[model samples]
Target chain A: MIAAPRKLPAPWVLRTFVVLILLLVWEIAGRHGSQLLFSPLSKVLTSGLQIFAEAEVLEALKTTAWILVVGFVLSVAIGLVLGLTVSMSRFTYQTFLPVLLLLYAIPQITVLPLFVLYFGSGPASKVAFGVSHGMFPIAVSVIAGVQGIKPLLVTSAISMGASRWQIFRRITLPYLTPSLFTGMRLASTATLLGVLLAELYVSAGGIGHLTRRFGENFQPDKLYALIAALSLMAILINETMRMLERRYSRWL
Target chain B: MSGASSAGQALTLRLSKSQKRLSLLVKIGVLVALLAIWHLVTVDEFVSPFFLPKPDEVLRVFFNIIVTGQAWPDLKVTLFEFALAGPIAVIAGGAVGFLISLTRYGTRAFEPIVSSVYAIPIIIFYPVSVMALGIGPESKIAHGALFGFFPMCLSTIQGFSRVDPLYIRLAHSTGASKSQLFWRIMLPAAAPTILTGVRLGLMLSFLAIIGGETIASLEGIGHRIVWYAEGMQTGNMFAYIVFVIMVAVLMNTALSFLEIRRGRQ
Candidate 1:
């Protein structure tokens, strides 16, 4: 399949072209198609700013953001603690790692109602659910980080008279930083999933409620606008995490 | 002194019989403690019984549903969506991914877009999906497939593009045909990574379908759980949740085992 190389458009140009074509198609379809089914990008963009003025939508966004932040912070804390604890000894690691993995594999969605039941159909349930979804990646990442260090390095560190605390601080902490950040990136994604899923499933209040209302009323413009806002939030969070990860790991 | 310290480190890690037993004890101890807490909390009414049904009540509900086959129709619906979605996602994703991987420039062009889109929940599309597909199995399948496709596509691209360059050079020097290089060298090399993607894609398909059903569907396992919850049949709801969790775990375990086994080959 070897052939002479041919000219290709710049990546960004191609990407922009692809996006533009899709938007053009969508606009055409929206014009000619059922109003019940589609909204053009222009309509969504115009209506998007107005959504921010609504107290209910603003409140939902605040609630969702708060839940995600609190849940993410707590998850990182718990994940680090559990990961460090389990990695303390080989026996502990061997014994408990599988158990932790099994728990991680169990889709947290199944227990969304259970969370709502236990914590009430409020922010607490959503936060708890987000924590559950978010914690595992960090925990697993930390575990891998700990276990990945060479035994020879540990032996040498001990030989040099590194105290348990000092060894952990000097050796493990530095090693874990990169993974911890990457795990945070992954955890952010999961946290968003858990919070959004709970919010959507219930539809009593918050972004989910507003979107459900919009859907029922066939307000496609508002629905698209809401989705776009949420997606922008997601992208910002992830991109920030990525930048943090890169900045930290630049030396490596 | 260094030797002695090294010896001590080795000793600390040694999994002696008593350590294994202690590990087992800790594992069982944790489970017993959790169950005891659940039992005590409900029995002592530390929490309202309305919210926290006793374990036996949950079990009874689970058993009764199974014996009466009440779960069958819901299970069937979920499974049908999964069946329709999973294969469609895999084949389509794999094909698209392979094409993207054909050139490094192509990968650079599209990979970022795929990954960035992947980070977004995309579940926001549910309301639109429900609207368009009318709250039927069609919406679930379509959304589930869409959800599953990205993971498969990402992994497939990773699998092909990340193949060792040295091997490709060797194959080329030996005058291997394009197809021969792909099938004989590339496929096997990429099989493990691709399998992982397929497994994840399959898992995601099931999860997406369940989530869709939970949100807006009239019937399915997820719908039934919501139905029970809304009706205040907490025990029945717990049963369905347990049933779904078991199904998910079993499939996940089986898929992992399949991956590990294939990896050996």
Candidate 2:
């Protein structure tokens, strides 16, 4: 006799259930726990909604968003150019790859204060920090992508009388797309971390200041709301990058 | 084909010796050039000394801090917090990951959820931690533990769940007991991936502790860097920054060595 098919909830349904249960626990804990330390989900939700109406918070968010975009774009451009240049010849790749890895290994937070000193406590410093954090992953990934291109493919293209430009555009570009996406996805997270770290470190005004204020003033609701918003933004950016990576990686 | 490949490999190996020397020379050349440029700009006053202190000054101050033991207290605080957070993250994350991987449905349902949460900048919750745990080592430990947890958990899940079922089946067929099966088959199979996760977790924990200190704490090496920066003592700040980088490099090097050795075993 054949066994009956097992019925199970979908992952999303289970996820929703998990979320609801968590919210319930949070609500109960917040109400019963220290009011000064924790805010209930209801209060946090209300405050989260209210923050959008605050002009100061909105302005700070816009500043952060603008800087994040600029930093990300700059990192991608620099990383791609540098990656291409170094990977052009095996000699250059051998000479420079270790340097890049060494620099990458250096815990960048140490130099963050130096960034602020040079760039000042402004968006410039944030962007610089973000670029520093984001670019290495891209450069490394790009190098790997290039190195992984089978020599046989290049030889065949050469035999077929494909010019350097055509060979690159046809064979290399498509092959590198997935790796580039992977790098970008990692870079996005790193960029966010760098920018946020800079922001949190010494912001005269912006989300950093607001976070400090909320924490110091015992405004747990507002603090939770602001964090939830930032977390949401991070989730959206990461998910978008992942989706793009998946799409491009399908060819592999 | 084998002969041709081996010959090619030998040729490449011979070429690599000279290539390695050339790379080292280039690396040294680059470092010297950067230092020269740094000295030139600062000495010529092309860049403000306040902004970019001379390499000599930074080096002098770095030695001063070490000699005077100015960094010891802050270093202790940072290390103490790391000590507490790193182990907690590894154990808790590993345990949870193992539990989740026990059932295929659990793995499918929860993996995405955990990863999605992981993608969120958990640093945004720093303020909440600061508020709840106060502006002390407790907050830093909590923050570091939270930051390290996701990687540890994800890697553990990936490691255990992906273990070859054939090995487990063979063990069972050989009359291996449950604990014996786990100890002899599953643990060895999953060791490398789990060790990698542990390495990542520990590194991130240390970094997060420093980051937390930079953000809000009154003590720790990160706070000292900020303190000097705010005071506009660029020389001392640069010194602390250099010291912190050295510590990080050392820690990461040690962890990588451990990972390699254990992975081989």
Candidate 3:
């Protein structure tokens, strides 16, 4: 039986109203609550600005950004190449896919200490850790994307006298773009998580060290502000990639 | 003509089968080659033992840890924290999500906020959690719950919101009470999605707890790795890493099985 259509509520207006109310409540609660856990919104705002004033915090931001970019690029490039090679032949896919998945399933975090041990407590360890974490998702997604191509499509192209290069360039590349974008999105998040976690763990030089310092000093305001800033950066990067995914998917 | 064509096809099939066998051999050869290289490099002292311990040493250490039962306490603590955090996250996330889904407007109002906040890796708040809860299992629990909460809540909302309205209307027309309607219609319909959320939450909860242990604290699997690493006990660290990965895999498998069972019901 066909169900009668129900009216969906006005989502935008309702969401806006809820957000405003939450902000108002937060402002009031922050203003009145104990100073330890709840810094007023205004105080946090000012402290956030002051955090940017510190050269070290700015440097940490720069370092984190650089690692994220490098790690993400490496993961995508390596993943794409490996994925293509493995998917090129059914024999390779059968022989290697299980092994790849086993490695992927292992909590890479378990070997994070090994990474630090081998690479030392430097950006190298962090980048290596990030790459290890980020590469798996991209590889898995790319394999899925490549393997998902219908055999009929390839057969049809071959029957029409399309050259190997022509088939790959025109048919395979376009079909894989959406999956590639999805892989990038996952890789970006994984890379950020890996880099940030490694940075925090190493605690020699970076935001992790700064976080430890603030925690030890009981500089809750500074710590809160710093975390907030980093969270915003993460959110911004995530949103930008999400937007790109949407835009690309629409064209596809 | 038919015999010749069949013979050609058979030859092609045999050629493909041999190619497959060759590829399998190559794959195994590659793995063995890698291990050989690792052994050689470490034995030659080109790479420091501290940096990359020989495979034999790692295996010996693993055997020692297993024999001595040195890893039990850390394993227990990590499991204990996970046991506590997983249920709390499911209940809290589910209750809150259910409340929010009661009204059409509420679902629209809260889901976006929940999802956007979730998009940010909540691990950044780990320090804050430590500050508030101190460096112990409590902070880990808090972090785990927070990490697990978003996915659970989002899926719960999706689950309940997608419950067919026709069922609700039929229940009401049949003079079913509010309690009966909710229990018979809403909860049952939403159970699969809710279970899916719980499964996702369980996985994230373990990851966050391990992360929290690694970043801080004196206990748990993650802490054990760091503890051994700092002590320059490379072999024990490798053993603990294996143990942790095994536990993660087991937990994931169990949860997915539970999800499938619930979906069937």
Candidate 4:
């Protein structure tokens, strides 16, 4: 029971070693394996630049980015409004909360086809899908944050003669910031998934179309490169949001 | 001023149980009203049938699909993919996690790599999968398994690594064999976290399978929705969408229940 604590090893050094070995193995396998089975890292890197030079790929990436930004902005605005409205009044909360939760619990991916049908396989569909996915997390989290405020604080503020508006501004809003940021981080990821899924489903324009083209043409190298680029974009967005969450959550 | 004060006091009175019941009723009422409005608008052509089919029409289509057995093959494909992917994810994740948890050094070396990768949305690799595996169920299964793998592995590692050393020490002192110690102590200690991982893995696999079908499948529930939508049969499309959502909800609920039940023991 009183066993001494185990000495922790150097994590980064071991990680680097493992990664290097894996990469080397992959490089070797790519050289020996069938072209269809694998593309060497060097070939992929060289052809990757060429794939990026394609105008359609560039345009598709821009369109995806635009949709992500616009949809996220709209989701945050709408989520904040709906979350606040529901949290403000017990009547509204009880009357609408269940419905909101039911909708949120539904697997939204199932409706991708319907979204495309209604929005005509355009940017509208992608943006709408993104907004739908992104809004729920923010709404749920914001409601939780608002409802979780310490009761004593509210009472004390009122006792001190703070106006309703002042109480909301000085207390509730600030209290909810950490949760709001956490929700936004989650929402951003969901939004990205929704928009990307919709875009991929449409397969008529944007990144999805390019991927489809590459897949059909058996351009594995190009496909891998393109996907890697998109993944990096997703990682960047996620990391940035996580940083913001960490920064704001410090107060808690 | 006295009357206003009295009114304020009266309004601040605690809610009765009946009021709580009434609020539930109101919530249901709002939902029903929303559906009613939907029905009315669609029936009246205020919204185009193509955009939003009537609820009755969707129900009729649902019945027809069920009666005609149109959904069976797609259901089989999706379920098969899910079945294959789910178990693969569990076993692979368990193995990797077990290996990582064997020593503090392994945990230090691999845990961060696994977790950081897990933090990113992994579905972005679907295109590469589709490219490698083609547009069939193979791609879907691969995509689903990959999506499910990260969470399962991470959770399993966390579970095993956090097992109390006190139990291990006691077992060792009691002349417990390695296999017996593992079965009695390690397995029981790690079961809850592993179960959580399995639940998450199953859910993600299901979602990824559906997403794969939507993206590029010749058949499956998702494909059926897209087919109906493209054919301007909005009613059937909506029905299929509802059916799929229901199935997902049921799957998630069942898994959660199972997890809770297991956790108690």
For A45-121, candidate 3 gives per-residue lDDT tens digits of 78756988889888987888888889999999988887777767667776777678778878777788888988988
Enumerate the candidates' DockQ scores in order.
0.48, 0.48, 0.45, 0.47
Measured as a fraction from 0 to 1, the native contacts recovered by model 2 come to 0.59
In model 1, what are the clashing residue pairs, if there are any? Answer: none
lDDT of 2 by residue, B91-173 (tens): 98999888877667778878887788888777778887898898999999999999999889998888887888888889988
RMSD of each: 4.1, 3.9, 6.1, 5.8
Higher TM-score: candidate 3 or 4? 4
lDDT of 4 by residue, B1-265 (tens): 1223423443464457888788888877887899999998998899998789899988898888779988899999999999999999988988999998877778878997887677566766777787778789999999999999998999899998888988998999999998998899988999998999999998999999998888788988878877887798888888999888888999999998999899779
Provide the TM-score of the second chain in candidate 2.
Answer: 0.92
RMSD of 1: 4.1
Residues A1-252, candidate 2, lDDT per residue (tens digit)? 012237877767887898899999999998888889888999889765697799998998888889889999999999999888877777787678778888889999888888887898878999999999899878877877877777789999999999999988999889888888989998999988898888888757667667878888998888888888888888899999999999998978
Q: Which numbered prediction scores highest in lDDT against the true structure?
A: 2
- Candidate 4, A46-116: lDDT as tens digits: 88558788888888889988998999999999899988887786666666667788888888888887777
What ranking emerges by lDDT with the best candidate at the front? 2, 1, 4, 3
Residue B3 accuracy (lDDT) in model 4:
24
Q: Where does candidate 3 stray beyond 4 Å?
A: A1-9, B1-33, B43-46, B162-190
Question: What is the DockQ score of candidate 4, to 2 decimals?
Answer: 0.47
Give me the displacement of residue B246 in model 2, in angstroms: 0.4
lDDT of the structure predicted as candidate 3? 0.81
What TM-score does each model's chain B reach against the true chain B?
0.92, 0.92, 0.82, 0.89
Window of ten residues with lowest summed lDDT in model 3 chain A: A1-10
Where is model 1 chain A poorest over a 10-residue stretch in terms of lDDT?
A1-10
Number of the top-ranking candidate, with TM-score as the measure? 2
